[model samples]
Target chain A: MALREDQILRYSRQILLREVGGRGQQKLLDAPVTVDGASDVLDVAAAYLAASGTPLFDRTTHGGFLAGTSLESFAPDAVAVTPAKGWLGSFATAPTIDVSLFRLAVSNGGLIGVPGGMPWPGELEGQGSSDSVTLGALAALVVQRFVLGLESSLVKVRNVDGRWQRE
Target chain B: MPHAVIDITSQVCPMTWVRVKLKLESLDTGDTLEVLLKGDEPLRNLPRNAADDGHVVKSLDTLGDGTSKLVLEVRHG
Candidate 1:
């Protein structure tokens, strides 16, 4: 599909990057990225990724505490974020592209703090009032992680000749 | 069989469907794609959309809190 005008403008910043030039941009538009998570988490990520010109397949449903469970269900080629439980027993396997995790707690009336350990940026201490904004921020953070390569973490366990090796 | 998984937590409409469609296209004929969605709009629309697109919806499991996981098997000839 040809790039739309708004798409070109919205993703201009990304397109300008050496790694994500016109070809990359085209790939993004053509390729689909699936997301599974809580409605708020997936919505935010999908909106940002889509607006930024990446075709998205958002599979976020209404319940479930962690988004990773949702991702595990869809089984996309790559996942941006997953729930905590999904990370278990699969630490050694990394997505071909990237995966992200957005963490948030509903407190006072705002989302705050983007902890370094989590993929989603920290909530803003008390910024949970507007769920939409919170979702948007989380989505933006996921995108940032994707761009910065912060989302891709390869957990390695040493094995010598198929045997466990001590570090 | 090739399987694709997506995590769509904390997200809302349009985006949910958009992501699903993209994943569907990536699969080869006879492959299956599963989607975990957690919103009302998406829960209502994703399966319908997938069916409309000619994919076979294998299953849709709904949880108590209103979240759902949909399994779609690509059926391109």
Candidate 2:
């Protein structure tokens, strides 16, 4: 989706952060995100997360399954089952305790598409130790670059003996 | 670090990765290239392709608005 002007302004806040600044923002505006899944929900959720700050999520079963399942199900189940109130108790407690569980369950059979997964410290660290706002600005800059058409130029070169020549 | 920045926005598919490969070849080992691009296809594909070509993707970040960027460190083959 195309970004609006207000988004640019709002995201400018992220750009202003020392870690991001204009250069980092430009870098973000130019980055790419790959979403692999059958459903668009994961894609949307990913979009939301990317906008929020952290980016990168495998929309596949393996990746999403862990986020949607383990976090949404197992964690909650372990907590609910501690009281031994049975399946009904687990169900009753599930919605109240963690809204993400209910949201994931109602949205799909499994937690195929839920937002706010584990933050990728590696990627964030790459952006430097900026605050969430700065990170968000960096993300905004990335989106801007994406819309602006900032891509590498490819020119094929042929090899003559050992040296290379552009084709 | 003497990083080279390539703005490959609007470009698509093989072209995006191809240009990146070309730029890396011009640099010596341990050089860094900051590639900027758009589109989901390239965002997902280029990093893997870079790795296959022996470049290390130091980081890949996507803006909330849908744009993306990748920082690749070049290692001589």
Candidate 3:
């Protein structure tokens, strides 16, 4: 797909990335990335992707997510994510990531994947200020990176005794 | 020997180079580009940036009324 002049301006910063050049940007634009789960992580992820030239397919109203005049969808590139109440069910049909910040005290806090019965992700319980935003943003970054064909792994950020753990 | 042309005389500082860089990205290997701008920062920095990115700066010439023209040959490895 030929990039328009405005698109060049809109996505120039990312396009400058060696990992995410015009070709990669085009892939992002063409890709239909769906973050079905409604979490702060997906919220921030949607914003960054849309700002970077990818558009939400749902055209989810601003403030419904972005919450300011800063939300503008120009040159929308067919990328969107909506709040999924039952996100686990969608995994069977779509490529989706299950993301949530959890409390350690919650019993049986298991992460379920598509078709169910997958190895449950561990529960993250921590003390002090829970930085859900940071965790969510990191998850979003991983999702977007993976969608853009960048190297990504099944990394988890768990909170333990007020400290964050990466595995 | 295909070439592309863009005029960024009205654009400001970093954005000028940003536009030029994007324009260059849009070009194919061995393609040439002509950039038109009218600012000291852009004129001073564009050629340096082009060279820094390994593109060949064919020529840099100032025009009457303060506009400048630069020729860049795209070379990607």
Candidate 4:
């Protein structure tokens, strides 16, 4: 379906991007994404996905995060419906290294392993809010790229001595 | 080879250009698109941005009332 006037205006900024024109915006609105996992991470990702107009599959876990908030308050086009086939992913934190991870395995079995050494229990405990936000943002970005069919590669970030190291 | 017209009078600076760009993307190479808009920012910026994207600005005219019409030719490279 062609974008409605409200949608055109609502996503004007995103449509302005060369990488995400009107067609991409339409794809996002039509996309049905399933986001499930820890509430902290799920809430942030769901908010962005909603704002982008990506429809979310109605799952009990999703409702757990959106119970109090109205999705329409921020996303005029956000809709949650019966479970549908679409992009799917989850988020989890690596307690040993104090890092949040997001991965989607494609046709070929993707790599699976933590690159850094393990830490003793309670050493990397107490993951902060910032970590959850970062993980959620990354998850949303990956979903958008997948919906738009954009070329993207694996990204890894590890917390090394309280500092982030990219590999 | 083809000609199209789109009115973006209600749209602002960036969206004005965005709508025009999308129209251009839908047309074939050498196709002409006429955009109707109302704003100084878009009047000044759209033509340049369209040019930067390899499209040709065929003409731009002010229609007396407050609207301006811009004509562009798609040039994909």
Candidate 5:
């Protein structure tokens, strides 16, 4: 199917990128990407992908907090999410995210572990508001570029220290 | 000799170019498309952007109303 008028307007900013011309945009629309994580973590990622016209299937923990979960509300019907609970291996049947988050797992006011240790480091204890915002956006970035068939190494975002760090 | 035609006379900018660009991408190299749009803005921008993307804009003509017709040729990389 052709891109409709509203679709064009909705995605013009992304479409304008040289890497994401008409064909690349269509690739996003065609690819079905499932973000597997807690609702809190996947919130921003879900919104970003959906906003860009990427078909999003959201997977969250069975009892994980959802709805009013994200710091902000994403557009209605923008996300087609399925709340589920199982081993991370369940996501293996589908494309396990090829990207990694090399964020600091702050332990005792310092960093620990190698980059890409886990999507969500347990050391976070209670996720701060800023953590949610940063993680959400980072998840979206990983999913969007993957949809466009672009390759990126471990992405280092602002760490628990609120400082940019890479490994 | 466009392979397809899309009418965006009721739509606005960026969408005009986006719809045209998508239609062009769906075609084979050397295939062409004809777009129907409204107002002078699309008329001014459509052909120019199509050319900038390395596609050919064969012709643009007024429909004697607020509408305009643009002809574009696909040139895929």
Candidate 6:
């Protein structure tokens, strides 16, 4: 379907991007992305995806700080669904590395990340103080890149000092 | 070449370009799009942006109703 006037206005900022014009914006809206992870990661990823007009499905049980919040509250075009049977992309996050889950995400062409600077196979060093927000936003961008047919690679995000670096 | 008409007189800056870009995406190379737009920002930027995107600006005319009409040709890779 062609973009409605409201959609054109709503996504105008991203639509102006050379990598994300009207066609790319429409692809984002048409894509249903599933989320799973720690609450902080889920919070940031869901917010970014919803604001970008990507239909979101919540698979997280942690809830955390965003338990009561609705993804649709983020934007006019934001939509949230439960038990989504199919999706174009998946994002998973956690404070510790889960080898099985990581392999699954990479194999399925999905994005998965651990909070930057967190030690492997262990709990987050400071939990709420970690940079899950930045990691989550990067994961959401990975989904956006995939949707727009941009070149994206599976990489880890690590916080070096105060900077979040992708490796 | 096919011709299409769109009126973006109610839109501003990026949305104006967004609407025109979407229309252009639906056409073939050499297809013409006529856009009726109002406002200085879109008048100044739309044609420049369209041309930068590889579409040709055939003509731009100001109507008596204080609106400008821009003619663009589609280009796709």
Q: Which candidate is the best by lDDT?
A: 6
Better of 3 and 5 by TM-score: 5
- Which pairs of residues collide in model 4? none
Question: lDDT per residue, candidate 2, B1-77, as tens digits?
Answer: 43798888866666566556656766778888888888888898889877876789898988655677788898865
Q: For candidate 3, lDDT tens digit of each residue in B1-77?
A: 33999999999877787777777878888899999999788889899988987899998898979999999999775
Model 2 chain A: lowest-lDDT 10 consecutive positions:
A94-103
| Per-residue lDDT of candidate 4, residues A23-108 (tens digit) | 88888876666554335555676777778877765444643223326455666446542122323343222001111245331112
What's model 3's overall lDDT? 0.57
Please state every model's RMSD to the true fold in angstroms. Answer: 20.6, 22.6, 8.8, 9.1, 7.4, 8.2
User: lDDT (0-100) at residue B37 of candidate 6?
Assistant: 92
lDDT of 6 by residue, B51-76 (tens): 88899999999986779989998888
State every prediction's TM-score relative to the real structure: 0.34, 0.31, 0.61, 0.70, 0.65, 0.71
Question: How many clashing residue pairs are found in candidate 5?
Answer: 0
Which one wins by TM-score: 1 or 5?
5
Question: Top model by TM-score, which number?
Answer: 6
- As a TM-score, model 4 comes out at 0.70
DockQ of each: 0.02, 0.02, 0.21, 0.58, 0.51, 0.70
Candidate 2 lDDT, A62-144, residue by residue in tens:
32212433223323321211211232223323211111322243244222111223223245445554333222333333333
Cα DockQ of the candidate 6 complex? 0.70
Give model 5's DockQ, 2 decimals: 0.51
TM-score of 3: 0.61
Once fitted onto the true fold, the runs of candidate 1 whose alpha carbons sit more than 4 angstroms away are: A1-167
Top model number, DockQ: 6
Model 2 regions lying over 4 Å from their true place:
A1-167
Per-candidate interface C-alpha RMSD?
9.8, 12.8, 2.5, 1.4, 1.7, 1.0
